[model samples]
Target chain A: MMLQFNVLAASILSQYTDFEEIDWNKMWEATKETLFMTVGSVIIVFILGLAIGLILYETSNQHSLAANITYRVVSILVNVFRSIPFIILIVLLIPVTKQLLDTMVGPKAALPALIVSSAPFYARLVETGFREIDKGVVEAVESMGANKWQVIFKVLIPESLPSIAAGITTTTISLVGFTAMAAVIGAGGLGNMAYLDGFQRNKPAVTLAATVIILIIVFLIQGIGDRIVRRVDKR
Target chain B: MIELANIKKIYETKRGKLTAVDGVDLSINDGDIFGIIGYSGAGKSTLVRMFNGLEKPTSGDVTINGSKISALKGKALRSKRQKIGMIFQHFNLLWSRTVLENVLLPLEIAGVPKKEQKSKAQELIRLVGLEGREEAYPSQLSGGQKQRVGIARALANEPTLLLCDEATSALDPQTTDEVLDLLVDINQKLKLTIIIITHEMHVIRKICNRVAVMESGKVVEEGHVIDIFKKPQQEITKRFIRQDTNPDSEDTDVALSQLLTEYPEGKLIHLTFHGEQTNQPVLSRIIRQYPVELNVIQGSIQQAKEDSIGSLYVQITGDNDVIEQAIQQIKNMDVEVEVINDVTV
Candidate 1:
């Protein structure tokens, strides 16, 4: 077993110069597509999820801003979306994605499905973040003659920013992983490259290379995220 | 001025209904440092929360500075709340904002122009003796400094009334005295009507002119501070006074009974003097005229409100009937008297 492991390791190490055998331009384009989808979906999800999370927070029974029915319905809807599998959601959103973007095979088509799949997940995370804020902060602002908008913007948002940023970072990292699953519906990214070049062409090197690159990207994003979180979390 | 008329607050818990504050009616005069003293779970906090409209009464009217705080809603209530400031036990300052910004929060919410808000914040910081710590967050300040910041934040909108809910309960003794001094300074300088809810009689004795004793969601006794101290009407009030006046008084009670056995011919009497009578030489006059040797064994002089009230345990030796007549003479002069029995029936 040890000799077999040494032989495999040597073969893989010697294959580095075989980079010319790989499609560099295609890999670059696919990388760009992945970045585009990841960033676009993240932006859309952040806006929608933050709004939804704030709604869920403000309209809950504890801090009700509206009737109980609306709050309950919105909460249930968020739970439902968050419960669905990411891959199934991508497949299920095909017709809607095509109608919305006039295509369902490229990064643009994958954008809506990516947002739909990730928004509710991020919303729940954001809601938890907001819920953890001390109620005393809200009462203090209210006693300061702050109207609802002022309290939400000046006090509540600032108090919860660190946690919300952390939630966003976690969501973005999770979305990167979910982007690979988006490939089942023919969306372009490193996942598609790995599938087409490594799986379809029966090449193990391509799959291993993409996996290492994905791990490196995840670590880099998380490292930067932790630094940002630490800077903001003064408490 | 603040008035809470028949205020009631009930919490529907899982066990059943719990009345946190029951039909409490109180009127706090302007420039009065009113202290509400009670033990834990005594609804002192619930009553104080109503002053700033943080906890709405179940059914009653809370009128402050001519506005019905319990009835006001939305933006009007918020505006009214700005005029009535409150500080908490935990010193709730926004960790995100600096000390200056925290002090300026009310002004920012009220939309004071950006140019004026800075100066107003600076004035408040300086008022609270926090001139140079404007940029520090709450986490960087000490407990007393945080309370000073809280006080500055509470005074930002230039409120007419300041409500403190256990404001000094979380501080050490030295810090408590400093905060109390600061509050007294604010009350004097700004002429702000202050209401302090605490479980410490020492806190009440330090600054309050009038006090209310709360127990089981009701104001058991309320009156002038000297009246309550010289003559506490309720058992809980007496308990508090005893604990404060003598922490070892329980053991003293037994020792006092034993001391009475040594003087059979003496009559033990407890005299309570308050207000102008505290300064009178009436005790000396009685000792001079009557055939009685007055032995003042145990006594304490407590400063309350507008006067010094005292409770003294005295023993008289002479003719029994003469001592009784002398006690009547003292009573005729409007002094409160209680006889301590030397023998156990």
Candidate 2:
């Protein structure tokens, strides 16, 4: 059965020049790059965003560790980062990206830029998630003698899990789109494959394949996120 | 025992500084179900929040069981809070957690051992009559059930003091009674000092041993529940008492106006009977002793806790001298009589 499938695939590839010209090895490498950039950036963004979001929530609260100066500073930082367009953000973050990754032209190099661009956006979403939680819940937890850390870990985070999961899903998908843009900086990925091989070389079939692969990744992320949200959402 | 001395909370908003709680001094005895009754924005909530240090008093001190709660900071304050549990108008259960988990939260915060936390949470769940719903989430429960979980969670740490901030105002009448009964039961069984803040006088009448009537951030009157019901001092207290006795009726002024138009030539008298006086046939005795015609207009007799308070409006038709004598006789019976109107034909 394997031999038969391989023969059929070869015959199909032979009928289309774009398919025949496709470097299967390079395509796999691009897929791996895309996955690496997306997964790495998402992990970094999740941690940084959660911390920033928590700080924003705590400092802004009147009763709970309310640091007005800290809140204002963080608020302005988030707004400034969020205001920059993602493409311009990548160019602006080039120096920091180079400093962090020691390179500026591969999937690994794209990660710092990806995280810098998306973490604030995700932080704002996470801040909203925390804000959406009833203040009474926080008060109730505090009244139970929960210290600041306990309130954040045990009550705030757990209660806002569903919303945070939704934010992760949104950020992850946007990162996928951002990874495609990362390819413009010579960060090899499906985006680079689609643009350099398919669009520039006029190979529509390669572009279609890359698009399908990205769509599948997005759908999988969405499906997983939705399931988590459903399981976690008691309200 | 919880003592609040000259407690005040002033909130500074964009407009200006607004005082939510004015200089209020109150002492809640141990094992007593004390209620703070007031309308919205009357500062009862702020007062109760101060008990657990959830709201910092702009001035004054809160002492609980010899420790100055207001003076506590950091770990001391957190430890102090563990002994004082609070339930909200909204149940405030963690939506991501199951009933048992929500109950276990306080235990977790106190760093109770895992095994002990499970057993304690289970016991509290059963205590709140939620035995089989340990795995159920709060959103899946009804309002009363959610409050039951809140009660169980609040009790998980075995808190000596329980603060209820309008705990039943969000519930329907029946649910309110059920929750109040649970609180009464908890107070009795555990000897917990429960401070309830509510806008509903009926809630106070049902469960509070003592009540403080608050108006515009001040405690206008504070006394025994029965005493407050019998002789309400402030206009707001009287209004609240009137609501408890006659929930659906119009205000006293409107009713008095209607009665005056109906009975043009009579002495309109408002009579109030308290405790043992409620059982006496004072009206009948007055009628028998005087040659006066009595026309009963509107009345309500309500049982508050162990005490019964009854109020009646009657128009007496007779000569002025005889009506005055009849009023004296009724007052002599320990019934409070107020001459509402005197119109002579």
Candidate 3:
């Protein structure tokens, strides 16, 4: 058993030091590219997501505004987009994505698809966060002469921050996961590097290394996410 | 001064249309602590919410000061709402903001400049006796402290009218007294008109100058709190006053039935006293002047709006003529008298 374990360890080491093995500098660049895409998309998602979420919430039956057919139609549209699979959505929007970004398979080109997919996801998160807030809080603010917009920003947003923080954390973790899948469409990231260096070349050690690095990234992201959630959530 | 004229609120639920507030007229005078008392869903909350325009009436008018608020909309309605501040049963302070920030929210929405907002919030916090808690979040405070923060926030804009929707219903008995005392202090110092909605009659007796008793979406009886307590016109109001002033008064009926064995020929009467008329020694004077003997079975004294009021249960031992004359003379003193002769042997 000892001799078999040594052989396995040596074989794994040989895969890393083999000719045409992954360049550490190039691999690090791919990780940086993945980080850039994930962070940028999250920023866009949150800003647009919050605006859309507030509108949806304030336009519902629970708000002072009476529910109407037009609002219901808009809500249906949001729900429909939210139900579409992300990768499938990317395929379906290829024509529009290419037209807008001048290409369909790189960081810049993937920006719109990333936002389109994640904004709806984050909007649902925000809507649920706001929904958990007490209706009495809104009524109290409204009685103070706060108009709808003022109530939303000054009362609703501040009151729902902890829930919103949780929402953002989970959304970001999934955001990083999504970026890995973006590699299947020619986006530059660790996924692309792992595919070419590990899968295409039949390098088992390279594949194992890429998988481990991915796990480490996910672990770090979740740890940071949990710390933030704990700090913000008083409940 | 506030007047609610023939106000009605109908809510359309999926089951059917329910009348939360039926046609009701109410007059609350300036510097008066007016209480609207009822059981849950008796339209007390719905009626109070109308005072601040939180709930619009289906028909009729809400005239505050002089303006008819039911006709106002948008900016006009919002401006009118500024003149009326309200607190809730739940103490709905903004959870994320500090106590000071919560107090400053209304002023900010009302367009108070940045320079004066902090000072105004500080003054209001001091008034509510939460000066040192300005930086604390609502979660960091006790229930009473949170309500104080809510009170300070409501008073930040210096509104002439303050509406309390079951304000102390959420607190313990001790904390309820403290918050009630604070409300009394605010009413005295600021001379703010308060409309309090509560199910507790003791709360009304403690601070309210006048009260309206609601039942089945209507004001069943209303007047000066002293008069209402002394001589309630509605059966429901009478029952509430009876239960509060004498919790075991119901069991007194069993005791009365037993005592009826001794007074088989005597008459039993319930007498009510109100105002300065109660200052006269009526019971002693009856003993001195009448050819009758009076036995006190149950007696109670309750104070409303700083006046002495009470109810007495007595058995009178006298002939028919003497009993009639004695009752007539007692009625002349402006006290209510009722005969409860249904005691089973």
Candidate 4:
């Protein structure tokens, strides 16, 4: 009786915990794909977002006609893009993505949609960070004979670094989620694997493994981001 | 020499057009510690910004050292600004930078070589008496120390002119004195032109060689600091001087009224002595010449730039004829005496 019970207990444990249906090699590939989507999109997003953010900041309060027009145009674009849901935005940008990337079934193809949605999301954050700076500090820089660009690069950017770092970290995390969502439309990643192999085939272990890994990635991103912020933030 | 010819600044807000500084004409000589004192809305701040071209006048000209600062644009204005540094009440420091880095900023802006920037910054840091806190940020500093960093940064480009816009207003009494002393030291050591804007008359009395009293975007009175203290022409000037000479003015006024009532037979007199008269016993000499008993009510002696100014409130009990004779003698000795019996008369 004891031997029979031991065998039964082992069977039950292996049935739930054993991830046999999960191809370890494929899972590893999916993780790399997810990372590729996140890292790739974030690099472009950070640059584009910062550019848009700076344009918005420099023009917003200026009284000139051209500045007002530029401020309104850029702010509206950011608002419209950042307001859209990621899943829907991916579908909306499908044709554009296809035209540019010529594919819609891999980590690379998801790049356009991921960056489009997130760059504006990050832009808003960046703009606010710049706005939060002390006007007196900027004036002080100008008084030191720093021209406009020096004021922006040396003072404004450095002063707002911690906020900007926090911004990119959040936008990158959302890009990760957007990647998984993109997988539903044939962009291959851990989400695609979990859906095809675990959800459709009813393998709970495979889905649980993907979920755990994604969480770990997010945690690591946050930890690294916070460290950078702390290091730069003397204030 | 710096000259302003009817300079004005008008701001157009959402509400309407407002005149910040109406029209002002003045000349500031090199190596003079000039002061402009006014209440907050009197345009003291607006007037000072003209010196650096930070605020171009809506009209008129700002000629600083023969350059038309108001007409300068873009790179010219920026390079011009490099020679004119300003310090603020808040210090307006870059909290992200350390003391050394903060001071290094202007040098960086002026394209100073890296090697020289570091050494020059250290020299200025030492000049401001912040020799060891080079790596500390502004947040870690006291109000006065942050201001020292401000001074060091302002002088980094070897600016020919320094503008202090209420620089000591945020500091406590002790720190205020320390910062003022440092400013005076910098002014004398560098032979730099310094312009101070403040609402405190004590600041003007302490270090200013000359002063302009502003009221409603206009200079109501402008003269040497000692001369202003001796003979304040405008009521506003008198009020500012009273703030310095009689700090606890409310109590002093009450006590003065009480004394006037108690000694109806006495004459309350306001006496001012400057330069040589301040050094001598002017009041004692006058009292000795008259058959009168004198009571020193309130008095203060202050150094204004290189000269000393003394103000005394006294009550004299004697025959009215003797008091008149004493006043004439005091005036003959180059003392300014005002009979405070206007209320009684």
Question: Which candidate number maximizes lDDT?
Answer: 4
User: What are the per-residue Cα lDDT tens digits for candidate 1 across B1-345?
Assistant: 789899899998889999999889999999999999999999999889888788899999999878899988887888888888889898888888889888888888878899999999999899989988999988999999999999998988889999998999999999998999999999999999999999999889878999999999999999888778877889799778866665566765766686688887688887888777777776798898789989877777777546776777788889988898899998887788878775332
TM-score of chain B of 1: 0.88
lDDT of 4 at A11: 81
How far is B211's C-alpha from truth in model 2 (Å)? 1.3
Q: Write the per-residue lDDT of candidate 3 for residues A1-235, one digit (tens) a residue.
A: 9999999999878876564666777778778877888888889988988987776776677534455554576577778777888788777878998888779887655667788887877787888889889899999989999898898889788777876777777777777777777876788777767787677977755666666677788788778877877776643
lDDT string for model 3 (B1-345, tens) is 788999999998889999998999998899999999999989898898888788899998999888888888898888778778899899988887889999999999999999999999999988888888888888899999999988888888888999999999999989998999999999999999998999998889889999999998999899988878877888789777877777686777787887676678888888888777667799888888899999998988887668877778888888889988998889998889987777532
Better by DockQ, candidate 2 or 1: 2
> Residue by residue across B1-345, what tens digits does model 4's lDDT show?
999999888999989988889899889999999999999999999999888888889999999889899999999999989999999999989988999999999999999998899999999999999999999999999999999999999999999999999999999989999999999999999999999999999899889999999999998899889889999999899889887887876666777888888888889988988888878887788777789888888898877777888888888889989988888888898888887753321
DockQ of each: 0.63, 0.75, 0.64, 0.70
Model 2 regions more than 4 Å off: A1-18, A61-66, B251-253, B342-345
- Pairs that clash in candidate 2: none
lDDT of each: 0.84, 0.87, 0.84, 0.90
- lDDT comparing candidate 2 with the true structure: 0.87
Ranked by DockQ, the better of candidates 1 and 3 is 3
Clashing pairs in 4: none
Q: What i-RMS does each candidate reach, in Å?
A: 1.1, 0.9, 1.4, 0.7
- The ten-residue window of minimal lDDT in model 4 chain A covers A12-21
* DockQ-based CAPRI category assigned to the predicted complex of candidate 1: medium
